[model samples]
Target: MMRQTRLNIRWRLTIWNALAFAFILVAFGIGVYQLLRQAHFDMLDKSLKNRLVTLEESLQEGSSVEDAIRDWVGKFGEHSDYFAFVCDGLQNTVGATATLNQVDINRLLPNLINDYGGTAHDSAFGRIRYASREVQSHGQPLRIYVLAELEHLDEELLLVRRTFLFAIPPALVLSAALSYLLAVRALSPVEKLRLKTDSISATDLHERIAIANPNDEIGHLTATINSLLARLDESFDEIKRFTADASHELRTPIAIIRSEAEMGLHNDADHSRTNKRLSSIVEECGRLTNLTSQLLALSRAESSINKSNMKPISIDRLLTEVVEALEPLA
Candidate 1:
């Protein structure tokens, strides 16, 4: 039973430690994944915004809308991730790259004036993130849209998640094993104390538990147990002495009674001498009875001393009570 209890404690310790570590590891993994995802998307949005600036500059330089579209396509079209589109105030697609001509301009610019910032939307070519802005070019207000493919971003994030999933189980197992070892090392002293105490018996009260570190809690516990053992040893020694002394005190009176009885029986014809022998025997018997009573009273007093919560008595009342108790015998 005790061995099972110890094993339960170690297992509980290991389990609690593993739980704490898992919580921290999971939280850290989630945080990293979010930060990385946001950072990657932010990079894509910035690239789109930068392309918008380049297109605006080309228009400001007095280039026609067709020339600006041609320049943008020639510069960034080769990169399959990039797409550019432009529209007039009527929201009609005016100029666009081959990559973006496939996208529905109406859906891409649903709220051209209101949705001026960046956002992600699904398209014919998987998912795409785009940014839009209104700018004056060639003395006319034009809306611009720049979209980037989201497939690569999604793929990168998927890889990160898979790596984390693969790493978690082995980390948790290692943590649990380390926690179990630490728990065992920490409880070794207590286990030793239990084994030592189990080997101790009443006859072996002189033996004490070994103390490894006096400043620690286990050391203090061992010291207390040893002190209790010392007190028990003293009590046992006192009991042995009491028993021996009581027997010794009774032996002399018993021997005297026997001798006087023998003498009285041997002198049966002489009545006076027989009477004197009988009187001596009676006196010894009285002594023996008195000795027995005194021994009982002493034993009671010692027993009371070992017990707790003794009430105090007034000396005058105590003396009066003693005198009253002995008056009948007197």
Candidate 2:
């Protein structure tokens, strides 16, 4: 016995559709996140540059740069804002709004003068946002360094990342659901085909797959299958008719042989009568041989019809040739 294999088109389609949806959604999400991060960094860079310019202008004023810086620093601290520092070439802090402890000044002063000049430096200090600018005063060049706590912007960035991360699960779930529904909708025709096919059996070979539509690939497939089934049904009918006809044709010859043998056996040593019966048996055998040969030829013809390669041919020429070949047999 051969084992039957079960197929489920719905589950197959669902898996394929879900995978496609996930691939597209993940690619889109990565692109959007990268764009957002780039925009954030650009905005932060621009803001740092503007603050550095403001500090430089304030320092160039005729008033005491240290005093002016102290006032600015006091106001900034009152508002819980970022601190600024201005230094001369000697590396000594000339003007600083915030108190410069040894560690704060030491860690920032060298990097401000050497590592950065009129450029934004994000990695100068560990976890500190620092920007610097070079300014000329009284024919002397000075470096102004600005330091701001990155905690606020860092927090905002962290929040954005978390929000996107959290959204991914729901997005994926929604995409999967939509993909499954679409797959189901797309495969409904196939499901119908399955049901129709299941309803038919070998005993009902006369039944065929319905071609509900004729313009699509699925319709074409249904039509082809139906055509095959129709051919099978015709071949089976021809086989049944041939079997019946062959049995009828053979019965007469078999009966004649049996009757002739019985008569010859019952007759009393009549040579003439025995020879006549024997001749009749020989004739019946010849007839049986012819019938069997004809049956075999028909079977071969039917098999050839089923397996032959089809091509365009002139119908009139083909028919004329067939008739000429069959003239003797007819």
Candidate 3:
């Protein structure tokens, strides 16, 4: 199933951390873009409104459209991102900044005071934010248009977006790597415990795992396992003691039975059926005596009580035998 094939804890942690970091990073990038875009547009709108207001006042104070355009153009200078133009009652362009073209004037000119006060797209400038106002110029109805290009704004935002795009993948990879390393470090104790547990067997129940700390969760779990092993050791010892005791008790009874059977066999030798029965009893007692002796030996082996008379093996010979035994499997 999918559960069995799923990623390990370390990989899962890395994935989760990467995902969380990606989300936060992307969210921060988007928020920064939104704030900068809004701020740029706000400043642009305020400038356009101020320019329109100043131009309206100039025209109202009996200033000719040409004089107003000249003054505004000089104030803006050569590197200006805005263009100002004026149209008379006939909708003919009477005055405009030096950079204004026929297409820019035609596509972007507002028809009424209510026409524009926000952003618009233009074929000449690609994108522009504009503000328009109707003003009295020498007692004739006049409309003035102010357009600021949105190209710079778009470029700035695009730069910000690109920076985030370039940074996200590397940041996610770094986060994943760090998370994986931390997971491995954190789970090392569990791995050690697993290795230690794997080495334990029925014959080696006395072996124990070392605990570094007794307060943490891993330490507590190891302590519980150690307690369980202790109980198991005690139970096995009890079983061995019972085996030895039963074997010792059975030895004398079986010997006595064999002697009685032999006597009966001799006394009943003239009767063939009775002699056969006594012979069978004698054979069974011999088997029982052998079984008890084997049981006693097993009990002693389990307790290691029969090894007192044995001498220590030579280290060189032991190593050679061990290597020979393992070479085939290897």
Per-prediction TM-score, please?
0.73, 0.76, 0.68
The whole-model C-alpha lDDT of candidate 3 against the native structure comes to 0.78
How does each model score on lDDT? 0.80, 0.70, 0.78
Put down candidate 2 lDDT per residue, 43-118, tens digits, no spaces: 7667666767766676576446676576565544533336677667777766665445556776766455444433
Q: 2 or 3: which has the higher TM-score?
A: 2
Best of the two (1, 2) by TM-score: 2
- Between prediction 2 and prediction 3, the one with superior lDDT is 3
Candidate 1 deviant stretches above 4 angstroms: 1-7, 111-114, 242-330
Candidate 1 residue pairs that clash: none
User: Compared to the true structure, candidate 3 yields what TM-score?
Assistant: 0.68
Off by over 4 Å in 2: 1-8, 61-64, 67-81, 99-102, 110-126, 202-206, 305-330
Pairs that collide in candidate 3 are: none
Error of 2 at 132 (Å): 1.8
Positional deviation of 173 in candidate 1, in angstroms?
1.6
Question: How big is the positional error of residue 110 in model 3, measured in Å on the Cα after superposition?
Answer: 7.5
Per-model clash counts, in order, read: 0, 0, 0
Q: Report the C-alpha lDDT of model 3 over 1-330, residue by residue, as the tens digit.
A: 465688988889888888888899889889988998889889889889988888888899898998997777667665468888888877789888878877767766543335556677766678778888788877899988887888988899899889988988898888889988988998999999988988898898887888899999999999998998888888788897786778686765465555656656566755775665465566556657766776667668767887434457699987874464333234
Q: Give the TM-score ranking, best first.
A: 2, 1, 3
Task: Please report how far candidate 2 places residue 308 from its true position, in Å.
Answer: 13
Over the stretch 138-237, how does candidate 1's per-residue lDDT look in tens digits? 7888887877778888999999999999999999999999999999998888889989988988898889888888999999999998998898888888
